[model samples]
Target chain A: MEKKDTFIKAIQENERLIFKVASFYTDSKDDRDDLVQDIIYNLWKSFDTFQQRSSFSTWMYRVAMNVAILHLKQRKRKVPAVPIDLGALNFAETGFDGNEEKLQVLRKLMNDLNLFDKGILMLYLEDKSHTEIAEIIGISKSNVGTKLSRIKQKLRQQVNNQNQKTAWN
Target chain B: MELDELKSNWENSNNRPANQNSLTAKMIDQMIQTKYDAKLNKIRYPEIGGGLVCAIAIVFIACNFNQLDTAVTRSTGAIAILLLILLPILSFLSLSKLNFESAVSESHVQVLQQFAIDRLRFQRYQKMNVTLCYLLMVAIIILLPKFFYGKDLVINKAFWTFAFSFGYIFLLVFSRLMSRYYGRSLNQAEELIREIKETTANS
Candidate 1:
């Protein structure tokens, strides 16, 4: 009973971390849900070996990343012909206007970035610092700084390009 | 707008669903069940390969008892074959029991680390298979002299010699084929990892 409670508490506390990581890896709600489930499953399996050497969140992030990566690999192998529909998810419920055009542009830009950069930027947006990001990503602190700087510049360019095209129209 | 404001606005504007608490609980339950099943299965049954190899060694030794007149030589042959068969099976079982899930919960970084370890294990298995084939060939070679000396041995000397040579060639071909198969699988796994890395780095 104590173990179950602790496990449930851990899940409740880290739920956002799982969801955010899943969202970065997958665009659709269904995929995000699957990724989150996989991460949770992985975490449960690893529960006994948790030595308390590192923070729980850091460990959870690693598990989430792994599950997401494996899911992508399996998807590639299976090669489903139909694409998932993200249209039904109300951006408005999340507070974004239900503007198809803007949403389409945002989705495209998100897809343009690589998985690692996406993860970094997602953590950044969640307000994780260079040191924390570096710890999560298994990179040097300086590398994180450089990568974050470059990522921001790339994002700015993409947004500017989109804005210019919109204005021209 | 400032960069921080823009990021905050983007984050605020993208209202995703509230994290599903119930689903997370269910997933944990599923994981526990799976782990329990795996453990029970391991405890209850002998490994398929280990059992098969033991049976084969017993049959081989039983058939060749008359030829191996000396008890010491016969016992040594049986023990050698058993060890050769057992080594790969034990190694495989140990590798199979590795806890990938625990590593994941420990840290996100350990995911890739685990995968790299898995690839190494596959390589080791390939080497073990090749070694086992060689050991079998050596056993056959040792037994060849007894067959050659027996006038009533079913096969002719020419046929025996040809078969021995062909067996060595067959081992080489088999090793090459198995290596290629494992190499392709490893390459595919690596490619998938690389793709994930690239996607994460860029996104």
Candidate 2:
């Protein structure tokens, strides 16, 4: 009973994070719902193993991400279902302002990323630190740095080529 | 906007709700109750059930094989016992490869690596199952009449001819249909593996 309450409380607190992770893997609402259920179930099942050694959010992120990976294996999809929240990103930052079109472009490019890189991008967008991302992704912190740069460069190149195509049209 | 520009915006933005779905207590209870593991793989329970039936037949044959009179009938009974043992082992091997819950705590890389191994093992188990099922069926056909009515169907020429023709066709069709159905799972696994390889290749 106590166990259930704590687990449920943790899930409620991080449900949005779970949804974002689920969206990265599952496109449809039904699939997302199923994936969420599986994640929660697995979390509850493995809750006993979860210790206070790490931050609860970091541990939860690892479990959520892995569940999504395992979920995709059960029912493979050609295109991962990403329900990008347009309102999720703020466009009023310094340097150059980003608009909805840019968010759409980033979202479209994300569709082309592999599960690992897509996961990195999602983590990056969430502003998770290099250490946290590495811990969650099971890669070294330096590897996370390398991969982020590679992914960003790749995204930039793809966006450029896409913009060129758009201009041509 | 440049990727760097977008990064700034995303970094500067406050935490917004990513999914509109709320985590209601009712929803939590429903999720906890949804035991869809049995539902996900349509083949798992059927395979287990088949294995149990084979196990019963195995015990029955072990006890009764000595009571048969002829050498040929006794040899057939021995062979049937062997097949019954093999049948369940193969099916269980295949089913065990798909235990998603067991790998939940494994890291992402470990999970993928394990999945790759499991998928290969699964296909191998499936092949073994499909091949040995023919023998299992034949053994069951030969042994059932002996155990139940003290008769041998293999000795009857007409029955052998008709049974071979019809059973061969039926098993062929059944195996083909099942292979196609189960192949969806294999294909889905392969698709994820291939995409992962392709995307990771860029990095």
Best by lDDT: 2
Model 1, C-alpha of A63: deviation from truth (Å): 3.6
lDDT of 2 by residue, A78-158 (tens): 122223322222211111133555545555787776666777787887889988887776767777788788887888888
Writing each residue's lDDT as its tens digit, candidate 1 over B92-169 gives 554462454444543343455456546556566757756765665565555545535633322457756876788779
Candidate 1, residue B150: the lDDT equals 39
- Per-residue error for A118 in candidate 1, Å, reads 10
> What's the TM-score of candidate 1 when only chain A is evaluated?
0.78
Give per-residue lDDT, candidate 1, residue B119.
59
DockQ of 2: 0.19
What clash pairs does model 2 have? A27-A81
Best by TM-score: 2
The CAPRI classification for model 2 reads as: incorrect
lDDT for model 2, please: 0.69
Error of 1 at A48 (Å): 9.0
